[model samples]
Target: MKESTGQTIMIQGEQTGILDADTVLITGNVSVPAGGTLTFLPGTTILTTGFFGINVEGTLLAEGTINSKLVFSVADTSGFYNLYDSRGGWNGINFLSTDQAGDSSIFSHCTFYYGKAFGDSINKMGGALNIRNFSKIRISDCEFKHNKAIFWGGAVFAEESDLKITNTEFSDNFCGTPGPPYGYGGAACFRYSDADLTGCRFYGNSSTGIGGAVSCEYSDVLITTGVFQDNFSGLGGALGYLRSNPDRPVSCNLFTGNSSLFFGGAISCNRANPSFINNTITENHSVSYGGGFYCNDSAAPVLINTILYGNYAPEGQQVYIWDVNSSPSFYYCNVQGDSAAFGGTGGIGFNSPYLYNTDTLPLFSGIYPSPFTLSDNSPCINAGNPDTTGLMLPETDLAGNIRIVGNVIDQGCYENQSGLTATGRVNKELQILCYPNPFRENVTFILPGEYHGNCSINITDMSGKMVFSSSSMKGNSFNWNVVTDKTTGLNPGFYCVSISAGKVNGSALILHVE
Candidate 1:
């Protein structure tokens, strides 16, 4: 283990390695010039002071083990210096590219915190790490926290780069200074870049402008199995997409508890059309529009087997589309409301061929880390569109379950397999059958002939209110008129029908439509 305690060290046109358990004190900047390679072994710590940082024009590899991790932080621990206070004390690592297609820099099992990037009028980005000009980088199993940027990308900023990040966490980072268009990407920002992010988590990040968690502009990105929670911004509490490529997709993600001051509490898209599949967007709040999603300027996103529920906004509690060209397509989704949930110029066509969509309660098991897990008796079970021939879908659900259990798939992010056996068969016999489920005015229920006793029928709405009831009816078949006890008609929505005969009780879901 080598210990290098210096005010400033410069490595030019050479290869260097920091061994395990090495402690380096960087009072000034460390520059790795062209044709240089710098590597850090496990248990290496670089303590910086003042505006100290590393400038790399070559390659860097900092790989650490689970027990021994690499840490980068400010060296000053003086009086009255909190984590947020140490934001501007030191700059962060900057990777500049002299070659367009070369070996990539890699960082794994690392922790970065309390770094700040306050660029001058010309250049400002990446509080912790910056990649520029066709640089290729890969980061995995890392944590970035408490970083701040004066302009954009509080944690990482990449421009025209190729980046792959997985199994990482970005938390408590902030960007911008209470202004418009300046603050973007509280965690990371990508411009004209290609990035693939999977199995990551973003939490408690804030931006003054847009994209509290991530902002992608003119970029091609594929994000899967990510969780975004409690992020805040002016728009796009979790993600902001601007002029991005429509070919790439974002699938199997969970967005929950995020808040926005203006638009799109969960996601905002402008002039970008991306495919979203099997994601759960819930409990997001927007002060203006689109508690779940917002689209403008010909942004036509494709949503498949997604869930949008429990979001709150004055206009478009689930989705908001500004213009007719910005018409999003929804297929096999479980939204919280009906056509009113889609606000703006385009109306009911926002949902395509509503064969398997429901405004009923999704009956989620929980709403925290995994927000859209299906309850045992959820209506979303086996209710998704089974024609997944060309759509982009993950092999497994958010909980790592098989994407399709039976011949049919479940809606939302989870595929429930509670009642089925290993071969996907029910252990018990069928209790009741209901035909013409989504009926206009009436629905018929059929019971087994063996149960010839008096039966009681009860129908309840989504709020668990008993809308219709019939007592002491002896018959094998019964039809409900879809009316309340006061002789008023029920609205178009979903309702639960419960039946009791002798000692047997059964329940089924039915939809009422106009």
Candidate 2:
């Protein structure tokens, strides 16, 4: 150990006690022995060279203030222009312990960047931070970016650990070696662990396989008020869960603009059962199936008050299920397509025995980071499951608004604070007039004076089958000339004419004579 007042000190071997306002340069691997504690003060910068890493078997406390942050960066940038060139620049910090209650590590207001963990072909795991063997760790207000791992987690990897990560941001991280299941998570990966992530943001991450942002196997994860956006992978662009507990839920989260090559543009579950609540999954594209969500091999995910829309795929644009054993449940969700798009032989739709879902349009404000705000006349407002017996709901929405604006909760991650009831319409008092009660020539529709804007008219039979539809109505009135249909002519019958102008919808009955 070489200590200097203002210059860099080469640190190796066992380090204990306090390191305040120091610039430590690591050229070789360092370790903290058992019962030892290494504490860093604010404004401390540790630059590593020669693939050096800090291994801790005791405790590490790196607590920095908002104004002063602890930075972990590479010492050499001679050939480092991109992630590939910076590979093996420095190994990351590793915490190893078998005692669950004894291990305690905390990192706050820290920045970890340009770390590369390419642990031989066998144990390639975390790129920036690794917690192994029942270690308990807490990370808060940290930033992890530009990290690369040859396999597994690009930023963090936890095995059999209990981790709590809050107010963190992970971006531009990557994992994989260009093939197969070797690449798991671009930001973080967990195995047989318990993780709780709150108020975190993961963006612009990519993986060659599995989860682009996060992946879990045999783990219990509860993610709340998190944002995952613009992540890419072969499966599960935002999150992938395998054999995870169903009771461990992901609530009040936003997943948008994620893309996958095979399945689950936003989320994928394989042999896993997890609950998703109050999540906005939109604008994600899948090349094969399940643009918004995917389930296979007995994966059963319960979706409650979630919004899935504007996703694109060849089949199951909103949700896709491959195995017949996979039974996904939907409650008070706003899905994109009809029952056919929800896959599986099980019942699907609003009236289906297994679903309280709807195909109503969820008018999102825009893409990711846009809050997914509901319009004033959106049907999703106040349309949520009334029973909140055992559900875990966040106290506030993504925008920090009250989760429930009115009596009932709103669907999706955002709750509108407009205080508008579900029964409120755009124009409740607008009147609709239909002329020619019993005519064979033509019929005309007139709108109220207060109504202005383009309106659509649809004539449906008594059996709820739409026979005639017109959107060309202009200036409040439209004349429909009854013409003989080339296939089936209009017979003497009663029909309902529904007119929609702005946010107001009204219907009028008309009669046709032979």
Candidate 1, residues 1-514, lDDT tens digits: the string is 2332333343322344553336756766777656667787767787776667788777777887778788888777352123234344467888764455446778998899777876563246888897788557889999999888878898998888778998999999988875455688999998898788888999999888889999999988888888998999998999999887657788888898798998899999988888888888987878888888988888878788888876767788788887777767778888877656687665434643344567755656543344367766566777777788876777888788888888777777677768442232222222567777557766788888877778998877655677888986687778776553353567865566778886666666565657
Q: For model 2, how does the per-residue alpha-carbon lDDT over 184-206 read when each residue is reduced to its tens digit?
A: 98999999888898899999988
Best by lDDT: 2
Candidate 1 structure lDDT: 0.76
Candidate 2: pairs in clash: none
Reference-based lDDT, each prediction: 0.76, 0.78
RMSD of 2: 10.9
